[model samples]
Each structure stands twice: as structure tokens, then as C-alpha cells.
Target chain A: MIDFERLRILTESAKYDVSCSSSGSSRRNTKRGLGNAEMGGICHSFTEDGRCISLLKILLTNKCSYDCQYCVNRRSNDVERAEATPEEICELVMSFYRRNMIEGLFLSSAVDQSPDATMEKLLDTVIRLRKLHRFNGYIHLKGIPSADKKLIMRAGEFVDRMSFNIELPSERSLKLLAPQKSKVGILSPMGYMATEKKQALSLKYNKFLPAGQTTQMIVGASPESDGQIIRLTQGLYKKFALKRVYFSSYVPTNEKNALLPTSPVGILREHRLYQVDWLLRFYGFKAEEILDENENLPEGYDPKCHWALKHPEFFPVEINTAPAEVLLRVPGIGFKGAYKIVNARRYGKLDFLDLAKMRIVLKRAINFITCNGKFFGTENQLAVKNTLLLTSTDSVILSQLSMFSNDEIRQSVLQGEI
Target chain B: MITFIFDGTKIGLFTCVFDAYYERRIPKTITDKQVQVGFYDNVYQIETDTQKAKRVSDCLKNCKTIGVLKDVSLALKSGRDDKFTVIFNYVKTVIDNKNLDVSKNFANESVLAFSDLIKQITYEVHRFKGFIRFEESVDGYYYAHFSPDNDITWLLMPHFASRFSNQAFIIHDVKRNVLGMYDGYNSAQVNAEDRQVTVYLSDDEINFKKLWQTYYKSVNIKERKNHRLMKNFLPVRYWEHLPEKQVEIASF
Candidate 1:
């Protein structure tokens, strides 16, 4: 058995990938092998950081030949390294799954010699977990860049979700920082799988990657602004029909790297970006509306507040008359709140008082909305902003926002481990 | 001389703590009305007597504060304004001196179901107790915050205080925004205030964050990193605490 020390290293190494949603798979458990890939396989449990602990998150090995400077496991870096064979991973995953330690397997690895070689080992383990072991569970397999499309496509069929990280926001950053990777190397496979996911789903292939594709882009590593990152995020969601766009904050592991930030990218900035991302996807606000290409997201307020403050002309929208889409544009009202307004308004005209009963954050919305032609909040934009900030319930609102959108909030809501 | 009176019912703005209670328990039984709404109407005065509201609250609070009453509510967790109203109304009938023992009198399936939910929420908090990992801030403070369903924030105190006894650490329930600070010997839990403790930005965690990020990026499968799946697992909302979420330049 690999020692707990090695286990910790391997699991911790795989923590940042953020591509492990065990929602859909059809693999079955074999008597000899240890697990299965079911839609319900990954029972995610989270900590305050919103990192999921349910999947037996591990790697085939941290051993690598590729020298990606951003990675601690880069071949040049001297770190405690370990590799698990196809069978070793199978046994560990099975044991962990059986003991109910995990809901699924989130497996990845550093490139040992070549992308193909690393990917083949990853596939071999998944294939073994399915064919030889007949283990069915939720398996999220990471796609190796520059790995053969045939192998990548094959693995796509077996895993519930597959992700190819658009690691940096742009190709130049990829070249400047991670010279070994290219625009084509990471994106070609992603393009192929997006099509494949579409084809499989279009055919009503329920057995296909049910959770679908997602990609991560490192924020603040390159010279990209929140607007650019968010625009690319919008494109990914729109063009590829992606389920999510993850923004991993750049942690300066190697201080001397010229392309990377000398210091860590602030988490609050990353948090604000996520809020903007939500507005892009769920809120009617476009990336351009949230922020211009020249500007970054406001450090003090979220993108929604920024937009509301910028366009005072949109303020004081009647809650009863405003459509669901327009209602969603308001800072305080979320998707649920919008739905409640739409539903409840059918009975009668809604006022500020009615909105309060619905648990709506009228502090932010009241300034922008009129109830029964009555306005309780200040008409002055600055006054509204000050009042909102003054009466602002920081933890409560952040907590509520986190509940629906924040990964950290999901950790608290999502039940079960593995 | 002829006199006429106008009457109608209207909902009003503003609410005290007990508005939700009346919204649920008060029957809309219009058994009696003095006049017609099309012409002369009866003015329905909105209730706003704080003293009267307090009496209703005092009774309800006493009924709810009892563990047995809450245990009977079957919410599975602490009654934090949701579905508690349902139970509060349902329990009102039997919440008296003659029927104080809820378990003995009404130990039905509703009670059992709520108990199960409580158990499930308890299990989740316990799991978080083991799963939460905090990075060392520059100032030698270990800060980890989570917004759990239950008051799992307190559940963490005994374990973390004993585990990191020598360290000054804070486990903030980001959801509740109430932080529990363990100063080695004593644990004082409080809400986040600007003047209280340093609302130090992410700069504090930057000094020692690289190793974790490096490890994180390295292990991503070049073939299969699903951003959506990852978001589903560890949503970006948590990225604020995770040292790695800030920035990473992919060194090709």
C-alpha cells in the first residue's frame, strides 16, 4: 500500500484541476475491481474553501518529464514524486469507494514522457476500471493536451465529464510562460470533444458524457483583464455550449518567472470575476456591459453593482411591470427571486412590502425598483449606493450569492462525501 | 344627512419579526364583512402593535426554544426561518402545559423525518470537520471559513482548538458571516466587523501559496480537465480562500 504521505501528495496535487463533476456515467462495479462510474457516483463534500472532498481525488503519478514552469511536478523541479500504475489506482479507488470514502474518482497526471504516454496510462486505468474490473462509478478523466484525439475521444465515452484546460487566457501567455504548450495543442482536443459531446447528446446518447465539458483558465497570470477573460468565458459558454468557466487564481510558485505575477493574484479579484461570470451566464448582463475592454472589474463593488451604478437611467424599474429578464438585472434579485416575482405578481400588483416578505434584498433593489408607484429608497444614485453599502449585510449577501453561485457555498449545501 | 364609509384590504410595507408568523397561521376566513368592496368598503388595518406582536412571539419563541419542539419540527437542522413556520403552526395546537412532552404525545413520522434531516446535516458538518484544510497566512494565522447548512461552525471549534492548540486560528462561517476565533485556550465567536480584526486581503496568503498552486496545475489531465465539473465540485465562490484561485501562468 502507498503510504498516507504519498496519498496526500497525490490527492493534493490533483486538487486544483476543478474538472471533477461525477454526475453521469454508466460503468459498473466488478467483483475483482473496485468502483463504478454512475451519474450519482461523485457525492461531493466541501470545506469552507469550496473544494470538493467526495471524489477519491488522486493522480496516476506526479512523476513527469514535461517542465511546465507553473507546476511543482515539472521535471526540473525537485519535489517528492510518486506514480501509481493502472492496477494500483484501480485498487485504491475501489477500496476507497467500497469503504464509502469517495463517491467517484477525479484522476489526472503530469506528463511522464509525452502527452500520449501520460494519456494512455490514464486511459488504461479507466479502461481497466471498466472492462477488466467491470467497475462502474463516476469517473472524471482529464484530457492530456497534444494527446491523440482517438484516445481522447475514447476516454470521453467512458468518463462522465472531460475537460481540457485553456490554461492561460491567450496563446502568447501560453508561449511566454508554458512554451511547450501551444494554442492548437490544448484547443484542438477541446474542439473535438465539444463536437463529440454534442453528437453524443444529440443522438440522445444518455450513456455519453452526461455532465459534459468544462475548461479552466488561469486568471491574472498573463496580461489579461477581467473583461477579456470574461469575454473568452462567454465565448466558451456560447460557442462550445460549455457548462462552466473556472478562474484559477495564479499562485506564484516560481518567483523568478517573468511571465507570472511576482505575487499571488488576490482571491477577492477572482471572486469578483466569478460574480461577473455569473452575470454573464445567468444575469442578462453581457461582458461588455459588466466592464469595458480597457477596464478591470471594480475592486470595491461586484459587477452587478458596478453596472447598476454606471447606468442610473435603468433605475427605479417597476417591480410589477418589469419583465423577468429586466427583474434579474436588478442587483438584489437572483434567479429565484425573479421567478417568485413573476409568479406572485399574477395575483396582484407587487410593492416594496411584498418584496420584503419574499426575502428579497430590497436594500440594493429598492433604489432601482418602484413598488406600487412608491419609492422608499433614494432617487439619487450616489445616495442609493451609499445606503446600499451602509445597510449592506456582508456575510449574509455574500453567503447568499455563494449559495447559488459560489463553489464554497455549494460545499456547505451539497450532502455526502464521495 | 347621509353618511358613507369606504373600506378595503391592502398589504403594507415594512415588517417586524413576526410578520412571517401571521402570514402563515392567520386564516383568510372571510366569514363576516360589513359592506361591499365595489362601493362602500371596510378598511383593513395592517397589524403593527409591537407589544401585541411580542406576546405572540414570546409564546412562539418559548414553544420553539424547547429542543423537543424543534426536534418535532422535523426540519433536520436548526429552524432558520424556512419550513419552521409550517411546524410552528402545526405544533401550536398541542404546545401547552398539558402537552409539553411532544415526543411522548406526538412521536409520529413527521418527527422522525425531521430527526433524520438533523442527523444528515450533522453528518455533513462532521465530514467538513475532517475535510477543511487551511493554508498559513503570512501573519501566522490559520483562517478557514465555510457556510454550512447547520451551525456546523461551532462543531468545528472543539476539533480545531484541540488540533491547532498552539495556533491562533479563525474558522469563519462565511455564509453566516459569523467567525469563531480560537485563541488557543478560549474560543470567542463573533461577526466580521471592519475595525475588529484585520480584513487583510489575499496579500497575506501570497507569501506561502505557490507550492499548492504548482501542485494543482501539474496534476491536471491534459486530456480531461472539465471546468464545468470542477466548478460543480469546488465552485468559484470558494476561490477567495483557495490560494491558487488568484492567478497561474501556464508555463508551456
Candidate 2:
């Protein structure tokens, strides 16, 4: 039987790795299976830290050989250690699935003895879950750095998703902080998996990592600027076709180290990176246009609004005639809003009131759009900038002070109501 | 002013729409059976006929895509006072105009309101899927309880039935006095009129609940304590149903 003490030690040690999302895979229940993965993932609950709990994210063993400074499971730490057998993990997952407590399983592990041995044990649990237990729910396995390439390939066939964390931004930092891990040890498997996924698509081999791969980068752990981090993110998406790249704000776990900072990285920096990521993926903004190579994203305004303020020539696009791509670049217009405008304009000419009724964030969009030859925004650029600054500052302060109370403000933020 | 009243059912609402169309007069208001009648309005009580309801549904299916039928059905389940009127106006517009793409016709208030009402109900269904928590009972059956703002018990049945096909489970919406029971093979609905019912949880189940709460507390980083954001994702209204949100007692 798994005791609560062992559970506490294992889950606490695994908490620092934040990849809680369980989306991007769909599977039907078999004849006698217990669960099914919905097309859009289900978030079971949100913890006090405001992060999603979609999967039973836990480590197989909290015993490591290599010592990574930022990691909680490092060998140097004098924390309590624990390990559970494969049968114990299977039993825990089945019980949780039956209770509707979790949607799937996210199994990671420390390098217990060796990378190959760790990967073998992780593979055994998933293989048993699928074949022996007939568990058809989602499973996301974390690829161990420097693990055998053949083991990674075989494991990919059984699981829905896999991730190899590019922990630090640059190679120099990896050598300094995490001496045992190298850049080649991480990127080789990522490159192999990307190629295999592509070949699987062409050869009609379905169910080879159906949910795709995602990686995480520690934002403030290294000295790389936001510009450098975003450039790397672009390369990952462009080259590997990554489903997502998560940016975790560095929390001070080991403050006594000389290389690491004593203070925790603020959440606002992480929030800014997310906004810039949205601009890259959805808004069709290139990394160069967003920020310079040496400069970080501005803390004062959002990436889109910041881009708008820098280039005044792109403003005042006619709402009725601009294409969908142009509408997406507007400050307040989002993917949903842009599509709504494009579809509704086919029926009749749209104005500001109609836009409001359709859920457009008119406060921000008003300055950049002209509705049917009439402009409701300030003609002077300076006045527009000041107005935007005032409104944006109010929202930032309000969100920082107390969130979730005001429905209007939340809707405004959701609908790009900047 | 003419007020049309019908039984609180989807077929009854559709039948009321049929009556409004055949009579060639739009009622000032449409309400379900539970709603109180106005003091000075001319009230018309319409009995629900499946044939008439089928005829209205057939017309909707024949006129537009199946998506329109889904929206109308969801709108009827919203439990709104004048939802029938909103759907009636929307269906009439779709049937009257041949070239009108009702999906894009946000300019029409009835179509817009009908779609928005449907969106609200569907959104509630999606949210409850994630928010519902189940506990194992002494008899080895799993039970979950929730009180959603929208009447979405029926919509949630299919998802749980598919996911927990091997387990016997019951989802009880205490506020609506309705329960959806799934017993391994088939699922059924039970009317829970008493509202006060309890389940005896097993010893291991109680301990599992404590373990889950402990896991929640352990995973939380104190520096990122944003209760506001937490409330935004998991609202305060849902705190009662969550095991993590419950206050721990020293009895164990």
C-alpha cells in the first residue's frame, strides 16, 4: 500500500516542474476501458497558486545521480527521497481516474541510477497501463536527457505526448549550473522525435505522439534576455513544430547558491512572455518586429499595444474593407473578434455599437479602426498614447491587487479589451 | 398583451412556437409552467403535443443545418422566462428568408440573443465537467455533487457516461433537484425532490481526500499566491464542492 508520507515526499519533489496541461489528444473508450481523452483537454481544478491541475503529474522516483542547481530533485539537496513501484503508480492512477479526479497521467522521473534504467522503468509503467490495465486515457512521458534513442522511439509509440525540457536558454549557462547535462544531450532526442513525427505523418502511421511535443524554459534562471528567449522560441516552433513552449518564472528553491539569485522572479515577467508568445503564434508577429535582439519586451504595455505605439502608420484601417489578417493585427481585435467581424460584415455594414454587441473590445480597437468612414478615436497620436497608458495602467494595477471580482474587467481582458 | 404559457419542457416550448405561428400573432411574452402569470395580461395555456413539436423541429431541420436545431434545443434548456419568444423569432426568421445565413446575421436581435443564450448554457456545461469532484462511497460506487447556475445535468450525462463506463456513478445537482445515475452499462435520470441526501464514504476514500488536499497545498508556491487569479479560474461559488477547499478537522 502507498502511504501518505511517501505520497507527500514524491509529489512535493515533483511540484517544481510545471507542465500541467493535458490537452491536444483525443481517444475513444474501448469496449471495456475506463476513460476517454476529450479533444479539448479538461482542467479538473485550479490550485491556490492559480495553476491548472489537469493530470496526475508525479515522478516515478525522486533519486537522481546528476545535480541540477535549479531542480528540487537534485542530489545535493538534503530533502527526503522516495520511490514507488510500477504497480503502485498504476493503482493510484486507476483510483484517481475512477473518481474523476484527473484526466490522465504525466509520468516523469529523476535519473535513478542511470538514464536508460529510468526510461525503462517509465516505459514499463505506461506499457502496463495500456496493455495490461486497458487504460486508454492520455499519457505524457518526459524524455530523459541522454537516454537511448531506441528507447525514446519505442516509448513514443505508446504515449500521446512527450517533452524534453530545454531547461536553460543558452549552452554556456547549462555548462555552468548543470555540469552533467549538455546541450547536445537534450537537443538530439528533440531533433530525432521531430523527424520521426514528420515521417509518421507522410507514411500514414497514425497515433505516433498524437498530441505532439512541448518544451519548457526557465525564464529568469539564466541571464538570457526576453529577446533572446523569444528568438529561441521562434526557432523551436519553426523547426520542430512544437505544440507549445512554456515559460516558467524561476522560483528560488536553492537560495544559497552563488550562481542563482536570492529573490524569486516576478510573475509579471512570465505573463509578458506569454503575451509575446501569443503575438508570435496567433497574431502573426515575427520576433524581430516584436523586440530587438538585445532588448527585452517592455514592462509597461502589452506586446501588441507596444507594437502599435511604435508604428503609427499601420493605424486607422477601415473596418469594412480590411482583410482578416489586418484585423488580427489591431490592438483590441483577437482571433475570435476578427472572425466575427469578417463574417458579420458580409450581412451589413458594421459600426461601433454593433461591434460592442458582438463582444469587440472597443476601448482599444476604437483608436485603430474607422467604422464606415467615421472615426471615434483621437486623431492626435499623443492623446491616444496617453489614454492608452492610463487605461492599461489601471488594469495592470487592478489585476495585481484583486482579480476575478469584476466580470466586466475580466471579460474586457479576455476579449482583448485592453 | 397576450402571454403564452406551457409546461417546462423542450417539446412544450416548441409547441408554443407552433401555436404562435399558426395563430399569426406574436405573444407579448412566453413563460414556462413554473413562472407566475402576469396580473393584467391575456394568458393562453398551450398543451404540449409531440406531433406539433415534431413538426416545428422538422421545419427547423429542413430549413437550416443541424447546428440550428442544436442551438434551439439548448436555448429551450436555458430555463429563461422569454426563451421561447427568442427562439420563436429566430426560427421564424430562418424559415421566412431563404438566402439568410442565420449564423452570420448577428444584426438581428432575436438570432443574436438565441445564440448567446445557447453559448451560455454550453459554456456552463463545459465548466462543470472540470469542476465536478467525485468521491467513492462505502458500496464502491462513485458519487459527485454540484450546483451549477445553468440546468446542464442532462448535457453532462454523455461525457461522464463515456469516461466512466465501467464504474457505477451518480451526479447530483442539488439545486436543480435532479440526478444522473450511470450504472456501468446504461444511464438514467432520477428526480431528487428531497434535496437532502448523504453518501457514506469509505475509510480509504476519506484518507485519499486528505492526501489530495495535502498534494494541493504542497504544490503551491507561496511567492505566487494570487487568490484573485485562483478565484477567476475556480470561482468561490465552487469552493464548497472541492475537497481541497474544505476545512480540515482533527478527528482523523
Candidate 3:
């Protein structure tokens, strides 16, 4: 029997991984199967840190041979180690899934014996969970850095999503922090999965990996600017067609290493990266255009607002006549807001009140857009910058203050309802 | 000056809409028969007519007013004040204008109000999907209990049904005295009080729950503890059913 102590240790070890999203897989339950994956994903619970605990995120074993400096499961770490068998993991996944505690399993291992050995064990658990146990839920398996191509490919067929953690943005940082892992070793499996998925598509075999691939990069671990980090993220998205590029703010787990940052990176940096990521993915922004090669994103304002501030010529576009793409470039006008403007404008010329009703964040947009040929924003660039900064900071504090008192605000924030 | 009390189902509400449209009478309020009318004004009881309901349903379906009918169904279960009137006016606008594009017509009051109501109910439905927790009963059936603000017992059925298709499960909505039962082959909703029983979890299941609760605790980073943020995602009301939120230390 698997004891609670071991489960606690494994879960504690797995908690640092911020990518517990159980989305993007849409597998129906076969007869005699215990579960299915929904495309929208279901977040079963929220931890105290406000992160969604969507899956049974646990490592098959915390025992490892490689001494990755940033990893808690490194060979030199003194943490107690335990290994779960394929059967034990299957049982836990089934039990938790049936009770609706988790969407599925996010099974990762610490290269206990060897990379291939760990990869094989993970593959065994997922295959058994599917064929033997008939558990057809979301499974996000971690691809061991140097695992065999066959093992990674076979694992992809069984799991919904697979990820190879980049950990550090650049190869130089990878060598400094995690000696055993390499950029080539990590990118090889991703390249294989991407090619296999394309081949599967051409062959009408949609069974390769439904959710595709996602990756995580630890921010602030190595001395890489957000510009360098985002460029790599763009490369991964373009190169691997990754489902998502997760940015985990570096938490100082080990301070002994003088190479790594002694303090954890502030979450605001991570938040800014997410905003930039959203702009890249949804708002059709090129990373190079958003930030120069060396420049870091500004702290006080979001990437979009920062971009709008830097270029004053794009401001005060007529909302009533601006095309959807132009509206999207406006700082406060999100995709949804842009769509609303296009849709509402068809009926008649819109005013600021109409924009407000559509839930457009006009605080920042008001500085950039004109309603029905009337300009409410200041002509002076300096005044506009101060106003935008005050509004952005005020909104942040306002959200924190208002969210503290109102349950609806807090709930909306969680649901992205605001 | 007139209130129409219907059977409180989506069909019943639509049937009332059909009747009100035919009669050319805009009702002061459309309320469920179970709830207090709150007024002595002229009250009419509307028995659900499938034929009448189908006419409205077909019209909306033919026009393919995407999300308008869905919003109507959600509004019926919304339990929000003046929702009936808002839905009625919104439907009237859609039918009158013959416009499927009224969804984004924020300038229209009824459309705006109905959209807001639908957004709320939709959000709640999505949240409940994540918030619900279950325990294994002695019969090996998974059972969960939830108290949702909206009458979404039937609404949440398809999600859980597709998820646990192979397993027999029961999701009881404590607020509305409803239960959604999903057998291995089929699924349906029933009155909770109609079928009552004492259920005891198996020892193995209980131990797993303890482990889950323990895991939940271990996963939280104390340095970044944000009670406000946690409550934002998992509201305090939902804490009752979650095994992780239990205060008792695990005996195992």
C-alpha cells in the first residue's frame, strides 16, 4: 500500500511546477473506461498560492542520478526519496479521478535509474492506465531530457499532452544550472513529437497526441532578460507548435549555488511575461517588435500599455471606424473588446458609454482611442504617459483593495470575468 | 400589471413566452409557480404546452441565433431577479427584428441585461464543474454533494456524464433538492429527497481522501500564501465539500 507520507513528499516535490492545466485534450470515454478528457479543462481546486491544482501532479519517483542544481530531486539533495510502481500510480489516478479530485494524472519522474528507465516506467504507467485500467482521462507526461525517441513517441500515443521543460532560456544557463540536460536533448523529442503529429494528421491518425506539446521555462534563474526569454518562447511556438509556453518565476529552492539567484523572482515579472505572451499569441505581436533584443519589459505598465506609450502615433484611432486589427493594438482593447467594437459599430456610431457597456477597459484605451471623431485623450505625450501609469498602478491597487472586500470581484478575477 | 406563474422549467417558460406573444400582452413578471408571486396583481397560471414551446424553439433554432436560446435556458435556471422579463424582452427583440446579430447589440437594454445574466450563470456552471468533489460509497458508486446558487443540476449533467461514463455516480445539488445520477449506460436528474440513503465510504476510499487532503496541504507554498486569491478561485462556500479544506489531521 502507498503510504500518505510518500504521497505528501511526491506532491510537495511536484508543487513547484506551475503548469497543472488539464486542458486541450478531447478524448471520449470508451466502454469499460473510468474517465474522459474535456477540452476546456476543469480546475478541481486552488492552492493557497492561488494556482489551479488541476491534476494529480506527482513524480513516479523522486530518486535521481543527475544533479540538476535547481531541482529538488537532484542527486546531491538530502530529501527523502520514494518510487511508485506502475500499479500504485494507476490506482491513485483512478481513485482521484473517480472522486473528481483531479482531471487526470500529470506523471513526471526524476530519472531514477536512467533517463530511458524513467521514461519507460512513465510509459508503462500511462499505457497500463489506458489499456489495462481503461482510464481515458487527461495525462500530461514529462519527457525525460535524453530519453530514446521511440520511448517518447510511444508515450505520446497514450498521453494527452507531453512537455519537455526548457528550465533555462539559454544553453549556457542550462550548463550552469542543470549539467545533465542540454538544449539539443530537450529539443530533439519536441521536434520528433511535432513531426509525428504532422505525419499522423496526414495519415488521418489523430491519435498521436491530441493536446500537442507545452513547455516550462524558469524565469530569473539565469541572468537572461525577458527579451531573451520571450524570443525563445516565440521560437518554441513557431518551431514546435507548442500548445503553451509556461513561465515559472524562479523560487529560491537552493541558495548554496552562487550561480543561481539567492532570492525568488517577483511574480510581477512572470505576470508581465504572460501579458506579452498573450499579445504574441492572440494580439498578433512579434516579440522583436514588442521588445528590443536587450531591453526588458517595463515594470510599472503592462507590455501592451508600454508599447502603446512608446509609440504615440498609434494613439487616438477612431473606435467607430478602426478596423479589428487596429482596435486590437489599443492597450485596453482585448480581442473580446475588439470584437465587441466591430459588432456594436455595425448598428450605429458608438460612444464611450457604449464601449464601457461592452466591458472594454477604457482607462488605458481612453488614452489611445477616439469615439465618434471626438478625442478625450491628451495631446501632450508626457501627460498621457503619467495618466496611463497612474491608471495602471491605481487599477492594480484598486483590484487588490476591491478584491479583498467583495466576493464577486475575487470570483470574477479567478474566472477572468473582469 | 399582470404576472404569469409557469411550471418553472425551460419549456414552461418558453410556452409562457409563446402565449404572451400570441396574446400581445407583455407580462409584468414571469415567475416560477413554486416561488411567491410577491404581488396581488392579475396572475395567470401557465401549464407547459410542448407544441407552443416547440414553435418558439424551432423559430430560434431555424434563425440559428447562436447562444440566444442557450442564454434563455440558462436564464430559466438563473434565479435572478427580473430575469424572466429580461429574457422575454430579449426574445421579443430577436423575434421581432428577425436578427441573429442582437447578441452584441449592447445598446439594447434587454439584450444587455440578458447577456449579463447569461454570463453570470455560465460562469457559475463552469466554476461548479471544477469545485465539485466526490467520495466513493460502499456500493462502489461515486457520490458528490454541492450547493450551487443556480439550479444547474441538469446543466452540469453532460460534463460529468461524459467524464465518468464507465462509472456510476451521483451529483446531489443540495440547494435545489436535485440530484444528477449517471449510471454506466445512461444519466438523468432526480429529486434528492425522493431517494434517500445512508452512505458510508470504504476504508480504502477514506484513506485516499486523507492522502488527498494531506497532499493538498503539502503542495501549498506558505511563503506565497494568498487566502484572498485562493477564495477568489475556490470560494468559501465550496470549501464545505472539498476534502482538502477539512481541518481534522489525517489519522493515517
Candidate 1 ranges with C-alpha deviation above 4 Å: A24-44, A47-50, A388-418, B1-252
How would you class the docking of model 1? incorrect
User: Between the candidate structures 1 and 3, which one is better when assessed by TM-score?
Assistant: 3
| TM-score pick, better of 2 and 3 | 2
- How far in Å is the alpha carbon of A260 misplaced in model 3? 1.8
lDDT of 2 by residue, B1-252 (tens): 888888867788788878888987678777775556668877888999999989988887777434677777677777566677787777777877645666766756776787788888888898888888889889998899988877788899999998888888999988888999999989899887886788898788887787777767776777788888888988877777888788632222
> Can you write out model 3's per-residue Cα lDDT over A1-418, one digit (the tens) per residue?
5689889888888887778888888888887677788889989898889888889999888888998888888888789888888899898888788788888999898888788988998999999999999998899999999899999999988999999999989999999889888889999889989999988889988788999999999888888998898889999999999989999888867447777778778888999999999988999889988995447988867888888877787777999888898889997888878877888787788998988888888777788888878988766554455556635337434345262466644654566544
Q: In angstroms, how far off is A156's CA in candidate 2?
A: 0.8
Note the Cα lDDT for every prediction shown: 0.63, 0.83, 0.83
Q: DockQ: which is higher, 2 or 3?
A: 3
TM-score of the B chain in each candidate versus the native B chain: 0.51, 0.85, 0.81
Best by TM-score: 2
Q: What is the TM-score of chain A in candidate 1?
A: 0.87
Tens-digit lDDT track of model 3 for B96-161: 767556777776667778888887888899988888888888888888888887888888989888
Question: Candidate 2, overall lDDT?
Answer: 0.83
Consecutive 10-residue window with the lowest summed lDDT within model 2 chain B:
B243-252
Model 3 segments more than 4 A misplaced: A390-418, B1-29, B32-71, B193-197, B248-252
